[model samples]
Target chain A: MIIGGGSVGLMISYYLLKKGVKSIVIERKYPGSGNTYKCATGIRASFTSKEHIALMKRSIELWSELRDELGVFYERSGYLWLLSREEDLRTFKTYVSFQNELGIPTKIIDLSEVKCLAPTIVIKDLLAAVYDPLAGKASPFDLILQSWRLLVEKGCKVLAGVEAKKILLSKKGILGVETSAGFIESSTVVLATAYDTVKLLEPLNISVPIEPVPKHAFITEAYRDLFKPLIIDWTTSSYIVQTPHGNFLVGSEIPERPSDKLLNRLEFLRKASKVWTKYFPWMKEAYLLRYWTGYYDMTPDHHPIIGPLDDLEGLYIAAGFSGHGFMMSPSVGEVIADWIAEGRPRVPEALNLSMSRFKKGKLIKEIAVFG
Target chain B: MDSEKVIVCRCEDVLLSDVLRAIERGYRDLESIKRLLRVGMGSCQGRHCLPIIARVLAKTTGLRIDELNYPSSRPPLMPIQLKYFVSDGNEG
Candidate 1:
């Protein structure tokens, strides 16, 4: 059984069903109504964390095949990280070499070469930059929006509008879950509820080390294609990407503020526009259309805590993706499915994301999250 | 007609296929693609080749002109104050 109907939940269900383990997914709201839909929809394998690099690599492989399988256009675009600070330059430089060592082929480019590569960008203040050509962006409208239907078609039972109250753990091996409607008996439970994971796992004494960070994003009206590629602009700390509908979607990292409130603040847009214009001066001509807020399932370290929680039998977690769950869900699903079927992860190295990492002080550091 | 061999990322001396293969290898996001292929990390900051890359991605993905990912943006990776260069003869 799986709790939460977001990207991670549905993806886990998908891989489980593929392995013949029919899963029942419970969602408090309709699928894609949460942060999964509000995500910036950037998928990439350029990461500093060794575990994420492996998982993202495998996840991206699945994403590539999923394009044809899902009948959706998971298109490829380059993610160019412009560096201005020596700190960022050094971080990216180390990441490039490390990524290359892992077959990622990331590299740092020079100033003259930067001009030749992306002339659309105004490079008057660039100090250095890192280039990863194998990154991409897909529309949540195209992928996550259709998750419920696709999941149903794939033989996973999705119980929408139903909330999992708590895990009904008894002597009977995680007896099942108590839901709003009634208790359903299941052998195992997988929590993919994002920030709500804390509440769901509270009964088991598992204090989910995650916080909900409110983030804001806005999109402009559909305009002619003026830009291509998802750019992480450090000066603005915003991720700028144009949606499939022609809207220029922009967002920035905000401090972690866990709350039930998800209101778009004018302050967010006001600052975000500064970054938008800083990168794309042409956006001034475009009109702002819509804006929304979502939460990032943040951990002490940016890396997510996947795998089973300590001392919890038949209970697993795939939460705390730190706002990057959508990009990594496919691989997370593959790994979890493998673990369930084989009593071990398909790749043992993935155990690095285990929740025990915090206790073991084995935290994996990641650098190429936004820039 | 040497478009294939023409430089896409001058920093890495990447060709067109180098950029396209970045996508094929599961680095579909623009940031990873650009960084991996060095398509837009050169001196011009993607000014010369980004449009070409965008056009190709749009065509390859069946996305309309508007459907492509927004072009990458970054602070100028250049134009550091000449004063910084004039700093106490440290290394240079």
Candidate 2:
């Protein structure tokens, strides 16, 4: 049984169906109604860790094959991580070295190359950039629809609007899960509810160190053929990408606050507009279309926690993607399924994403590009 | 016409008076009013009521018609039944 029908849960359902394992996905709301649809959809393999690089590398390969294999639409428009300081440049160089060691085609480019890649960028304070040609973007909604169709065709059950109320566990282990509608008997239960995973696991007394942080993004009125690659300025904590519809999607981090209100904050809009106007003076005249918000299931180390719980049998977790879950879903789902079924994976370090790391006080910190 | 005004979004009730009240609250912006009253967040997603609400807000707030901002467009763009999505188009 899978709780939450976002990208991760949907991908997990798809892989399970492919492996001929019977599964049912229960979503409190409709599928893709969570953070999955609100994602910026940028895909990349540039990470300092070998595990992240390998997982993202596999994800990119699967994204490349998605159109041909799953009949989905994906565009490899490339990604550019812009740097504005010497320290950022050094970090990019180190990340590029690690990515290269993992057989990922990533390299540090000069300012001139950055201009050539994205002509709209103002390169006055820009120092260097990490370019990954294989990195790109995909449509989260389309991917979910296609995956749902495939799952239905393979005779899998997807229960929408059915909230999983509790995970029923016996001395033997997880016997089943109770939902708003009825109870589902399953030997294995995977929690992929993103920010809601904590509340969902509370009944089982499984505490995950994941907190939901609000992230906001806005779109501008479409400009024909302006920006080429998805631009990430590590210094400013901002990124922008031109959508297929011609509108530019812009996002940035904001100070954390506790609120259930999903509405866009006025302060965020003012700050985001200032950042955009300063970086790309051309957008000063462009009208801001609309703004939306989503929560990031953040972990202290900024990496996702996958695999089974040490205390409980037949209980699995796949949350804490921070902001990268949408892009990394395809590969994560497959790796997790392999680990669950075969007791190993094509990439071994993913199994090391155990819950015991937190207990052992072993935390791995990465260069948080978004934070 | 006053009695004909309907409260579409239950989370906010958002009667025509509430919209005018938002304008009196110094919210000359349509997006601001929508955010305050949730006028466009019902199951219809403002499909049937946006233009009327915009006109009312404009007339009541004494703002020019073109000065009002458009409400945010959510995806799925249409109101889809949850059962239709899950049950392969066999509506419940």
Candidate 3:
């Protein structure tokens, strides 16, 4: 049984179907229409940690093959970050070492190279950049719907608009989950509901160290040559990427505050305008097309908690992706599926993502989370 | 804050009638109710609807409004355009 019908749950259901395991996906609302719909679908593996880079590498592979395998729209326009400060460049060098050691193919390029890649972008304060030519974007709606279609075709059950109330457990180990519709008898339960997992499991004294933090993003009206690749100003924590339809998708990180308010801060737009103008003075005249807000399911250390918990048997969690869950959902789905079938995650480092990490004080740190 | 207004979720344009229907169907928690009717899951990030819906829910369920556990309000307290939907690959 899978709780939460977002991309992670749906992808797990699809993989479970492939493994000959029929699972029921319980979504509180229209499945895949929750936080997954609010995600900025960036598929990048240029992380500053070993495990993240490895996991995201696998996710990127799945993303590239989705065009033919799942028949969805995915583009590999690459992600470029402009590093301006000396200390930031130094930290980025270490990231290069870690990412390179993990086989992510991330390269540190100079200002001239950055200019050639995105000539419209101003690199006046550039120290260097970390470029992942493989990083790109996709449509969250398309990925979720296509995965749902595949799940339906495979005879897996998707019960949307149905909320799971609790996980009914027995002393012996596994029992079933109590959902809004009724009770589902299943030995295995995967919580892919992100921060919601905390509230659902809190009644049972199971503490999931995940919190919802507010984030914002807004785009400008379609402009010709708004930049081909995703250009990020690392100093200001702002980024701009042209969509497949020629519009400029822009956003920046606000300090993570423990609030669920989904209001777009006007200051975000104002600061974004200043930052964007500083980088690309030519875009100073660009008018806003639309603006939206969402939240990130942030963990203590920015690493997600995957695998089954020791406190409860047969209860698996694949949540706390921070804000980067969408890009890793494809790979995370397979990881959860493998764990359910084979009794372990496909990636060995996944052990660090378990709930025990918090207790053991073995937090896995990612240097480039908001990046 | 308008007691006479019947809005439940201004972000999605949900109404008090729809929320009343959801609570009538045995939905108790604010999280479940939000999922069912998107009450506080809108643009104002529940600043406008949170207290109102919680008050109505408290009256219906006999639980204190503060006693109810609700999901966090998401960001962008305002509405945005759909043109940006085509690509959000780097929202991280």
Best by lDDT: 3
Ranking by DockQ: 3, 2, 1
Candidate 2 docking quality: incorrect, acceptable, medium or high: incorrect
- On residues A104-220, what C-alpha lDDT tens digit does candidate 3 reach at each position? 777899989898888877777788998988888887767776776677667788886689888888887778888788888998899999888999889888888988888778766
Tens digits of lDDT, candidate 1, A1-371: 88988788888888887788888999886666666767888888888777888898888888887777775557777677778888888777777888899988677887776665555567778897777778888765445535556677667788866899978777746899989989988878888888888888787787878987778886665566655667787755778887665667788765545664776565665667666665556555555545667788888888887887668688889988887898888899888888777777875678988889988888877655551
Q: How would the candidate models be sorted by lDDT, starting from the highest?
A: 3, 2, 1
Residue runs of model 2 more than 4 Å from their true location after superposition: A257-263, B1-92
Per-candidate clashes come to 62, 0, 22
RMSD of each: 13.4, 12.9, 9.4
Error of 1 at B23 (Å): 35
TM-score of each: 0.77, 0.79, 0.79
Candidate 3: where is the Cα deviation over 4 Å?
B1-92
Q: Cα RMSD (Å) between model 2 and the true structure?
A: 12.9
The local lDDT score (0 to 100) that residue A160 gets in candidate 1 is 66
What are the DockQ scores of the candidates, in order?
0.02, 0.03, 0.06
Docking class of 3: incorrect
Question: Where is model 1 chain A poorest over a 10-residue stretch in terms of lDDT?
Answer: A139-148
What is candidate 2's DockQ? 0.03
Better of 1 and 3 by DockQ: 3
